[model samples]
Target chain A: MSAMGDSGYRSLVDPEGGIVDRSIFVDDQIFNDEQEAVFTRAWLFVAHETQIPNPGDFFVSRMGTESVIVSRDRESKIHVFLNSCRHRGMKVCRYDEGNTTSFTCPYHAWQYGSDGRLLGVPQNLTLYPDLDKSQWPLVEVPQMENYKGSIWATWDADAPPFLDYLGDAKLHLDLTLDGRDGSEGGSEIIAGVHKWIIPCNWKFPAENFLGDTYHNISHESVDLIGIGPSAAAGQKGRRDADIAEYQHVWAAFEGGHGVHSALRPAELGYQPTFRDHPAVEEYYRKCFESREKRLGDAARLVPFVGTLFPNTSYHGGQPRALCVWHPHGPTSTEVWRFFLVDADAPDEVKELLRKYYMRYSGPAGMTEQDDMENWNYATAGSMGPVARRHPFNYQQSMHASSWEGPVAGQVSTQISEQNPRRYYEAWAAYMDGQSWDQIYSLGQQARGNGR
Target chain B: MNQLPRTSAFFALQAEVADVLSTEAHLLDDRQYNEWLDFLAEDIVYFVPMQRNVEVGTHAERETTREGKDMHWFEDDKWTLTKRVEQILTGVHWAEEPYSRVTHLTTNTQIVTAEPSVDDATIVEARSRFIVYQNRVEYEEYYFVGKRTDTLRRVDTEIGWELVRRDVTLDQNVLLAKNLTVFL
Candidate 1:
């Protein structure tokens, strides 16, 4: 099929000679293909063991097209399984979450233990003369792994090992999981999960976190967390006209992942006290002061923002959180946010974390709701024929691309089309059947480095 | 149910409690935030513990009868509540856009107590069933019905009761609609 005619996959480049793909957000067939090819095959995040700490505790979560139960058995070990019953395909556990030793399928009296073991089959001999009770346990997910207390599972039997898939992302994950001190232990999802749905492709939000800094400037006024609208008009009055310096931003990693730290520096009005805060201020200082001795001069200079490949994004610093963008359909996505706080942090610190969580991402949170509304509204506009006919532009700062680093990297100005360009580059590679390793290798090749 | 007060005293206290409750509800529904703030005591405690189904039996049975969970939905003093109101008035508080239209009905008022030590005022405990239906623009309306158990003490003048504490026990675990933008 032609690029435009293709349902699941298409290549879109801007008029100014850049690739731009819109099929990922519009085609239902493509959505179906992804449900099986991407979501089911990958080791998707379910729930942290901390969420269900005690025995018989369970939390219901969506794994792409399927509903799976993540629970703690009597042994206090975490287990993940298809929530459906072995007999009639009825959902065994109905509540969103609860504690129960055995789940009785309401259709019949067949009961299953927390470990996905078939405990009872109503009347084993009477119901079916030769029924084998041992063969009818609840269907468990193919593989379940708990790495650093965050539970993840995969449905595909032939998928690569979890650690190999994680690659360099594991280091970033550890940095996130292990609290700033990395001494008294790590942070926990203290406030529980804040879940809500938005009407947009899952990747749209994922790419936003990946590197789209344009929205920060274009949608500044509408952004609930952004600087006041008057700040936009008074650009000349500002001391540092270079938006980057005013924003306290940083981005770079071994993988395609990047996050802007504009909200974390002192000059940027937003992060004036970022250096004063005890948790990350010292970590930030140590990295900056003794760059060579600590994290390496190059690494020390780059303050972390969010993750890149696979999935998941972390907002470091106080009132920290992890945002997981889960695909719901071609045009709908559900975002589950887990606010983090150091397990040993003071009660007052936890309270501050709670206030921040509610302010930014909670059900009544300011910025999150606005983000959702804009994404949803944008999706609606894309559905229009004429609007979509005009390829969505990413042409801004196209000429600004410059080759840099050890490799000939397509470096754009910090606030340039770098994110969207890199995103499409990765998307084309992924759709064209390149493994994540191959894609990251290509990125490194373009930058003249070999991994 | 058995510990209800004497009919006459109970009726009088019930009448006073209902009047005070209606006035408070009017102030809230009418968006008289400042006026409503005056009705609450300085050290008021508001609680809304999670509700669960329990079977009637002995104390032992009740002990393990699902130690119903606790949710501090609004575990705040006056300051926090004041800030919340102020935020609602701010231009950026989008959750309240088109505002949450509410009709708070407080009925079935029955007094259960009268303190003797307090000279002019009365320490009357009352129960009133309440239902608040909120309508959010372009979205579905939400309904919340629950029992409002309140402890009321006489204000300085002894004319009416001032709510000392309000324990609102909601009947459902899962919220039935989108966001909850209004106070229960």
Candidate 2:
């Protein structure tokens, strides 16, 4: 970790155990290194299997600075290809999402099959008769796999297996994906992928998603504009109530992923009224059971686990999502999210899920907009050279961040900076060029018997 | 193709609509959000209908709902618009801060029809196409294409017709900018 500081990147450290210092969220050189060392090697989420349901269905996604096309082939197999065409470096597919048997690059009419195999190249029959077609196929991602129905691809061959990389975060991922499988298989993604770009470092949203319950009190408490039913109802009177609820997960997983479950304490024992539908009830029951089984008899039950690692973060069975944290430059990041629904579920269930996701996490959602405002103002204000000189502090409750294994106790408390500390800890490892194996070993040591 | 000369009543109605829209755009561009609220009619209805193309067979006989050609984008109302505006004034608005510069050039104003034999009150609709050139501090320019429909009435001696309704139908399905925070 000290070596990372030697690389001209200043490390903010606190001996008391909380976040000592972190400028990665605002630095330019660190952002450039992240594109190479982190994004280029880390497995990035592509799309869900349900998104490209049939042959020829395709959706474009970005992993760090590079763009890739994730599509399903004639065999219904998912393929990840660099969006650049083999002939002239033009984008083979222009549409954000569509169904196409073969993509013909507009630049030179070179066509490629859904499987990423080069199908046709204009004038190749005569001009490059000796050229091998097999060597010119779309550049396939080095590693691609599906965790449940969610798709992920990596550019680095040295990346670990998808499941192994997920580690403890895998349980939460399974809860989000497989938990729905308990009743009628599972759900599917609807027609649209809920996306919007917020003007902040992608890490800002990532950190907020991972842990930042303080914002609901700090920002939303003042501006009571209603974006949804819950928010509207909460703000209907003289003294408006903050429309955010929390249940925070206080743990870290292997692969550098971590979780935080935050929910309003008042909502405890608030059972769903319409559980008569067997399928719906079963799905909800499994969700509850999964949390209980995983958390055991902790005093407070966490409804979801916020997994923050690599480049993506989200919770299992939860309505919120945080992805990309995609960098626009040194100080700005474009954040995109998918508030998905299980396709196999009923329309009413989908509607409920949509409203839930839309209410708190979507672009226009209440909590989400509140977050964007603060992030925008903070990042925008921190841009001035004078402001950059100020070392942003995170030294709060570090020594008190006690844990039994990976799960930190008293994490749901609003003032805990433990999550940010954990985040920077893993970040420090990556900045120091620690191999994945070595990092995992260190993470296990950090978590003790949790692994 | 022969039509009567545009009348004084027509010009008055058109003038009202143009004034309302320009004022609205100014409020948005200048971020003078609080003042923008007074222009909207309390019962005003704002809708950007999602247009979709239905198959010719399903929508035969030259009906409007044909696939690949027809679509709807946003169908909103006064309530929704008010809420949208409120979010901005509250400082929680993320879409428009350091606001995107926008200039609404509304032209080709025409009075399509005027209800005849009506009392002092007259019902007339104005049609105009506008091009909104907008950009943030360091982003690419976004071209917003659409036609604005304003229902206006000439009241007493006001400088412009009093706007009762405004509807904008954008041609593009996907919003090019990061977010749509201003009126076109």
Candidate 3:
């Protein structure tokens, strides 16, 4: 609606006043512009390498609205390529996931190698003799990285490297992907993926995951009826009561990433989780003791939830998983959730965790069911012209956040909107076509959006 | 499925199975959640698995996620299922707080197999199709179409049969609906 680029973004998003215009969630033009501005430049999380362990294994994944094939080539090198055939626009491979040496487009007999090389035409010599196979390989992403067994790619060649894009956010994410015993990265996806659709803006879930402690009321229902692992043992809460002993930290990073982690007051002790099964209880107790011993005080920062800038989100503890809010439209999101567990954990530990993961996440999940309902209607409520006139408030504990706080970036002890405010500030920078220098070096004083 | 012997007792057993399904649909649609719980046995296992797209021949083995071994939409037992009902009845489960108007349209009833004989069946394998339509909060609506394979146990109570196990094959790879707050 408004002119885009440099000046237009400031009108919609004002991180200083701690206010954001509602159009960002419902407008079609702005949503369309985001595909090129935000989605293309950001390092998006594709399939984890563990999903396709051997050669020729492929998984269909999404970057934004477009589909991409994440395949392990014949040489076992991972590649993220556009799923479309170079000749026509048909999808090269239709299956969600499988092992294939090469993909054959159903529309035409055009075959491609797992490395995305255009291998054979229907009639290579006769049909088009001048067509060079080297010229028409599937459009590959310009930049790619495998950080902690997870794959991330970006279309922008000028974009910063994946770790630099992650910056301070990597430490928070390692707690999710690393093994419970303080191993660097031993987590792997479970056998299946929970994919579903939700009628809401992508940012609704993204912002929710980025340290929104204010919306705990959204999950009051699941909280009332305990669905935690220890719920069967007369616990009346949505998660383990062990978190109650620690101080909650809402950590924000300059690269638009933020996390809700916890800090123990003093020395850590074994927290009684998985009380229903003694084997599971014992397994976790050993993990906790070893993690405490290995990482020393570093293990005190237990991860709760986090969002990596533009789209990816993760639930580190409880329902351990990663979610990518793939945008379908301004008001529709195709959510893909991948459950994670230690690849070498005991069968009992993996079994109980998988069962608890299903009960806590996805469309049918008890805790996440209410979340979808809230996000769905919230998108609808913001669609009308009458609602767009008034701006949404983000000024919770405006100056209460500290830049020199313990964890990373800006830190807030009690519940605060400091993370979301800074998150939007960085989002607006991207929408304005800011350079990587501006996006990563957003050094501000109390989130006032000052240079 | 082998052709069932069309005896008079078999016909009578068919009627009893159909009534059990039809009655349970009414109890759920009428917002009588507490009463609907009566239809389930104490050890009922309700599972809804996520579907995946694989090669045709592998459909039987790898199409749907495993019941106890993989991630699924639901792998709930009696305790977890009861908690779901309790959440809706809490009047604060915002997903169903105002309560969506849902209808369980079940059809294609077939009695696959029965224990002992159809004449004196204690446990029966029943198959049917379901199209659960839910309309909520003004303009929100979704159609959940699926197949249900249920194991029903004959009881001496007024309800006639209780559902011991229900395996729902939702005809969706990626679930089209947002939240499955309403039962399928």
Predictions in order: lDDT: 0.59, 0.59, 0.88
- Show model 2 residue runs off by greater than 4 Å: A1-23, A175-185, A194-197, A221-223, A231-247, A262-268, A271-307, A315-319, A344-366, A383-389, A405-415, A447-451, B1-16, B19-76, B85-105, B108-184
* TM of chain B vs. native, candidate 1: 0.81
Ordered from best to worst DockQ, the candidate numbers read 3, 2, 1
lDDT of 3 by residue, A1-451 (tens): 3346546686787776889999999999889988988999998999888899999999999999999999999999999999999989799988898888898888887899999998999978988999989999989999989888889999999988888888888898999999988878999998889899999999999999998888888888888999888898888878778788888988788778989999877765777888888898888889888998899888888889999989999999888899999999999999999999999899889988988888789998888988998999989999999999988999987777776777877888888887787788888788888888888777454356431
Per-model TM-score, in order, reads: 0.73, 0.75, 0.97
Q: DockQ: which candidate is best?
A: 3
Provide the DockQ value for model 1: 0.14
Query: For each model in turn, which proportion of the native inter-chain contacts is also found?
Result: 0.06, 0.12, 0.83
| Count of steric clashes across candidates, in order | 12, 37, 0
Instruction: Please give the C-alpha DockQ score of model 2.
Output: 0.18
lDDT of 1 by residue, B1-184 (tens): 5675366655665677788988888888998877776777777665554333222342233211121121233444554455456555555555565577888988888776567622233676778899988876565477878998888777774335566788786666433433445666
Query: Would you give me the overall lDDT of model 2?
Result: 0.59
**Can you list the residue pairs that collide in candidate 3?**
none
Residue B42 local lDDT, model 2: 60
Task: Write model 3 residue lDDT over B1-184, tens digit each, in one string.
Answer: 5768888888788778888899999999998887788889999999898888886786877788987788988888888888999999888998897999999999988888889988889999988999999998889888999999999998877888899999999999988989988777
lDDT of 1 at A61: 75
lDDT per residue for candidate 1 within A45-73, as digits (tens), equals 78776778899888887787688889899
TM-score, second chain, candidate 3: 0.96
